[model samples]
Target: MSKVENSSAESGQVKVPESVVMTVKNFRSASDIDNFYRYINDNRLRREAKMILDTVVKAITPPKRRRRSKRVVH
Candidate 1:
């Protein structure tokens, strides 16, 4: 397995793996290519949106504190 560098943030471009590219190229119908691209884009968007929402929620939410019990000394 090759290490994939995430340069999407820096370049604003998605780096499709060579294998996926070749597979897509081998697809017979144009609709197949379109559907594949759409699926990829939708998944990427959903993941990114979820990450952003999680970050925002974490930032806005307060941290939980544990409650301490009081003990009586005789």
Candidate 2:
């Protein structure tokens, strides 16, 4: 039996949906154990925000200069 299967049986609740239970387990593993009980948590938006901030940082930083140069002289 799977983790969700065992949990559902112990809690006296109807068999939990596989996808929902997997999502719950993954979310719990990603966060600290102390707050893992917060079932409403979703990190997708938080990770997206971090990605946006990183992109903005890269945009604002100066680009590296190339050694190539073109000049004409007689």
Candidate 3:
């Protein structure tokens, strides 16, 4: 766990624990032009929480039961 520092103007206060800045930096540096798409695709959930809802919909959906086929007499 790393700590980042940022300062506020109006309040004149200093804050820390802005690790997301580091995460983005790491993400950019590690990813190449072609692989960047994969990186974004992989991190889409982290970028936007709404993706979890979409995944939940798929997870909660009930699977359709298949009807048994009757065997014909030979």
The best-first sequence of candidates by TM-score reads 1, 2, 3
The number of the candidate with the highest TM-score is 1
lDDT of 1 by residue, 1-74 (tens): 23344556466777877756655446755676678668768777767756877999999999999899999999
Backbone collision tally, model 1: 0
lDDT of 2 by residue, 1-74 (tens): 89988898899988746655546557657555435434324544656666877999999999999998878787
Which stretches of model 2 miss by more than 4 angstroms?
1-44, 69-74
The TM-score of candidate 3 is 0.28
RMSD vs true structure, all candidates? 15.4, 16.3, 16.9
**Residue 52 C-alpha lDDT in model 3:** 64
Give candidate 1's error at residue 52 in angstroms.
0.8
lDDT of 3 by residue, 1-74 (tens): 23333325445675656653456547656546338656657877445545766788889999889999999999
TM-score for each candidate, following the candidate numbering: 0.34, 0.29, 0.28
Candidate 3 Cα deviation (angstroms), residue 64: 1.0
> Any runs in candidate 1 off by more than 4 Å, and if so which?
1-44, 70-74
